[model samples]
Target chain A: MSTTKYFAPSVEYAAKILIYLSRYKSKQSTLTEISKNLDINKSACLRVLKTLEANNFVYYNSETKKYSLGTYISVLGKRVGENLDYLRIINQFLEEVCELTGLTAALVQRVSFDRVMFISQYQTQIQPRLSISVGNRFPLTEVSYGKWILANVSEEERNYHLREGLKKVTSYTRTNLQKYIDELSEIKRSNILVSRQEYTNNVTAISSALYDWKGQILGMIALVGVSSLIDEAEEQRLCTVLKEVTNRCNEHLIQLKIEAYEFPYESKITQ
Target chain B: MSTTKYFAPSVEYAAKILIYLSRYKSKQSTLTEISKNLDINKSACLRVLKTLEANNFVYYNSETKKYSLGTYISVLGKRVGENLDYLRIINQFLEEVCELTGLTAALVQRVSFDRVMFISQYQTQIQPRLSISVGNRFPLTEVSYGKWILANVSEEERNYHLREGLKKVTSYTRTNLQKYIDELSEIKRSNILVSRQEYTNNVTAISSALYDWKGQILGMIALVGVSSLIDEAEEQRLCTVLKEVTNRCNEHLIQLKIEAYEFPYESKITQ
Candidate 1:
């Protein structure tokens, strides 16, 4: 997957149109509107939108001459939920964590080299609880999952990532280089990372890394709650439950030997 | 949304790539395999794929030199679920139907001019039950929802749609034009559609249309079970429950006046 100078500007604009529609999904947008807002030529926007509508990625309302996100989006989402075995399995564990701890539990997977995303979540029914939704993304150095990743990687690589230093997300965020590195060392030893109001103010999160059969980091199981509702004792108790669940999850992953599962679609790039 | 001869070939190919990845989501595919399978020019495919990867619509695994569906797919899916107000409300009603009748409940929405997709479903826990997933699409002339749709439309339009006749999905499928029209007329009077083994073998379904405050056809609420488990008496009972629920749902929609809800993002296309 070497970086290539060749690019498809039409495809890029098409993606932009889809994302713009996603933000205003409840409303319909006309081609001219999309073109002006996205700053693409009107003719080009129409072509892209028509191609998308032809594929059911966007729904065009003929009566009103407007477009919205289409049913294919739901279909793709369903595929993501069903085809990913690990996501399916982790969702059940997330539900259990939400029920047991009365806190929002989320499964965050590394989506790219520098981003981790919440792919699944079970919100607690408890009042004044923290809420997290699937698809929320954070930078690799900005969340508890990032802490786990940084702790587990080679020291050289970790240092390379840390060269920019951490941004202060909240008042409690650890931006000091020495202190943050010390915390990463502790995370490496304990396999658990806890932060209060570091990502979002008034929220405390307890996160632990999960591994697959190959001993590769798969994702992070994070439990979060309102800081006002969690005292020191409650945090400790919730942390224990979270650790136990992640440990069980990792053990189950090893027993399943999931990494060895066949991927029949490999087409080697000869280039 | 006038039909246009103009098309963006690159955008179309990009969509095809994403859909292909969706089918083989658990595995990664090499650029060559994607190009060969999709018959897209190798260079063109690489450019589109690189654009997709840059946008997080596809993830490139550097070590394996392969690509898979990316996190943006999940994000777009999340947008569909969260932004569609009716889908969210109907989901709760579907859950109730599942609990009340111990049958799989689903919400079907018209997607395109001639297609309807299963956008939401709640599978039954009962043994020997049917299972349905979101995104399963069918022609508007086939399923129970189609029955409601056909019945609701003008006679001339309905006759035109009926001219081709229905396909024989099973021995019980109604293929005779007149007989199908008669059944649709019955549905018109009762506002309910009952189908057994018409879409799939051994599956019995009862569906009714839901309406917004404007009385337009919103979608269908369907309850399905194994035909063997649903005798004539059981079917009648289930029909009654389905009708009652849909009526309640309609009343709720009217009260909410959901269509009156503001869509702040409407930018009209001034030709």
Candidate 2:
């Protein structure tokens, strides 16, 4: 099998096992299930799981003979420390957004090329309210949280990012390449990104980018709720609250910036 | 070179590199610096860093020739999922404890054999307060949080855990093995663990094991502050608050159990 240079297949496979178990449908996946789904040999899969288990990167249940992501990931992630205070501040803002708009709000940070993870979330008392899981991921090219990040990058960067076809998440999602790029540019101009049944069919979300005092993109502040409760005019009002909170957050978060980006996500792509 | 069964040296080294960069005294580490510190060959170090960067497990700053932990760790950890609500509950209790005691409070979770990771922390308006980073680790066999968890385990399990020599973290720390085991047994009776300038000088911490409704130890809830502010009476009062908050938390967190515990941390040791 051909692999990229500098990529160790064993190590990559180990990491994949971890990422896979975190998203596994069940709380744990058996060796046979993992090997089959992840396309690895059974022995190699066991070996990888064993190594992960040894390091507490994954836990194995002897009775079920299944594997799950370990607490070590959370421990290591927390040690990525500089942004702790920033996340706390974002969480407080999320609470206010949820409170003011009678909806749920979340702070979404880009996790990878294809995913943005929720760092913090707040739920309102509004009946039939919806809330996203804190550590769950959304597609970068699909969800408004992900698209806000995608839209802010330069054209060259955006092209390199979406070199692969944009996978449609829902029927309402824009699929045409030119149209998608055009929409991203439009969102950038408006400085408010919205998704109505684009990511999940019943949810409506409006998001805006957070910037530090130095003009660096920190993450995205999103106001999310049940689609039935939010409308065009209401979304516009929530955007106002989001902007105010983000502006206040920018003042406090200026010093807590995680300056290391994805090396411009392919420093080569940028060049 | 001989390596333990199921342990991939390269994957282990890559994880080590990520952990190292996180705790590195400096903001970033150069290839030579990491190689020299971690005792890996320069070529191997370069290869690991490159692979980690490609996977966004590490970030490479070409201009500075430095490496730092990547955002993937945080993202993946968040996706671990089951503990998110529990962590949020813990954070709330911490805030309440901190508010009541006029001290800093933290929730600590066992992350490994020898360490517990901070899950949440809050500081009050009291002057000269102390706090720890949420993701930072403390030795399980040394500090109050670790000792609390250690105390609950069977003596056989405890002995198996620290088969290796326990390193002294501070001058006042108990270093004698027999004395350590005896002290652990004694502390279990009192149900409160205190570190009087043991882990770090001038910081006093008193902790109690936070348990779920099932009576399994979830983690430790600690009330910490400058030693000057915490007298014998204050410590007692704070413990009351800590227990009350943890009890309230247990009610909310009963449904959020992280059931995937390490499969008998000493399976090999038992053999």
Candidate 3:
């Protein structure tokens, strides 16, 4: 077996470059400008820039030595827009959950290792909502959605992520690996994860996985609000609503021909 | 003078890889999969993927060997959402214009060389709204928004984009360079670009430029509807409404401290 693990190192670099570009897409940036701004080595940056230019990610004015994002960046922008339309189908359901629970509702997904991305959110009319951008990422190990995803991940993958030690994002975050793993197993069995300010203080969040037709986790739906508003009773009610709304969303996905899958692998150790 | 352009090569490569990744983001292809799909050498794909990976634009599962988008993909998603918020701010104005003219009202931005991204839209009650995604891009040299953007682009950039001939996307699209440039100049001075079935037969569109506080062309506001409903009188009314709405948006941008600039340079050649 060829033991070379496919490390997509360049993809990571390109993504970093794109994020850097997002901040200044409206303006032109020179090669040295990008290198200095990003702290990337000049020669490597030059090579990447050449590849990007050839591919249409940017256009370089040979005369002025200026570079701007190419038209294709907008193509990706368009895809993002199309993906957002998927959220509209669940908006009403999310709003109802928010109204019924008096909590801020959110949709989130585990986009990568140790990072959970917020997809959409609905705020209660009275309580102030968390300022979470749709595409913003937070530490996966320290969030309710993160735990939910961890609950579903394979043991090998879980160990890989956990080996780094859950970087403490907040004082309330779980620090013990065994405890965190146990909690994930429990949540996996029960299909819900609840935390009292795991990511922030004075906030309670209860989340359930949003599954496709075949039971694969597409994302998580959660209700978060002031800790005072979500006691055990409120948590139960929120869970009930979360389950119902998630099922409704799954049905919508089914209509769209998406299959939901259960966690694909069996847990190695019995809890 | 050091004539060697910096960031040009990297920008080019970035654009190419981004376009490639976009074609597969929805499909969830692996690096090997992308290599095959793009018909590029696997080693090159690996290099590109590594760069994208480091930047959080693409992610791969070492266990499953599956590749998907990373957290940074959401950065563009958030941009579209922010732009949607901008559209929301002007929705009332667009709705009023739609009602006044019995046409479909839209907010568009030049997203690429030949594409206009639709930000938001409202259709008159009687007319079925043209279904366009919030991030959808249309060619800039063909439709009303395209013509408007072409008219507003600096002479140099405009010539650069037009040198290879505008991509003919629709049957009524103009292929002649000089004629189109001439028409664009007329539209630029008049502050309006009108198209009759240029993008789609039976659809007539009239557009005006949206400017920032400093009066720079930010985007275009357009009205589209069936040709029968868009006579000379209707075109005049729609043009007036577009100008007024654009002015309101500009005032809003001014309040937000955005600078508007006109096309950087004027063409030397005259009709």
Write out fnat for all predictions, comma-separated. 0.49, 0.39, 0.23
- Cα displacement (angstroms), candidate 1, residue B128, comes to 6.9
Report the poorest 10 consecutive residues by lDDT, candidate 2 chain A. A262-271
Better of 1 and 3 by TM-score: 1
Question: Model 2 residue A200 lDDT?
Answer: 85
Candidate 1 Cα lDDT to native: 0.75
B18-111, model 2: which lDDT tens digit per residue? 6677673743888999999898888877777776765556655555577777656666676554534455567777888788888888778776
Index of the highest-TM-score prediction: 1
Compute the DockQ of candidate 1: 0.30
Identify the superior model by lDDT, candidate 2 or candidate 3.
2
Query: What's the TM for chain B in candidate 3?
Result: 0.68
Model 2 chain B lDDT-worst window of ten: B262-271
Using lDDT, rank the candidates from best to worst: 1, 2, 3
Reference-based TM-score, model 3 = 0.66
Q: lDDT winner among the candidates?
A: 1
Candidate 1 residue pairs in backbone clash: none
TM-score of the second chain, each candidate in turn, equals 0.77, 0.77, 0.68
Predicted structure with the largest DockQ when compared to the true one: 1
lDDT of 3 by residue, A28-139 (tens): 5778887787777878777666555544354455434655554345446555323433445566677878787778888787654457777667886684665556666677
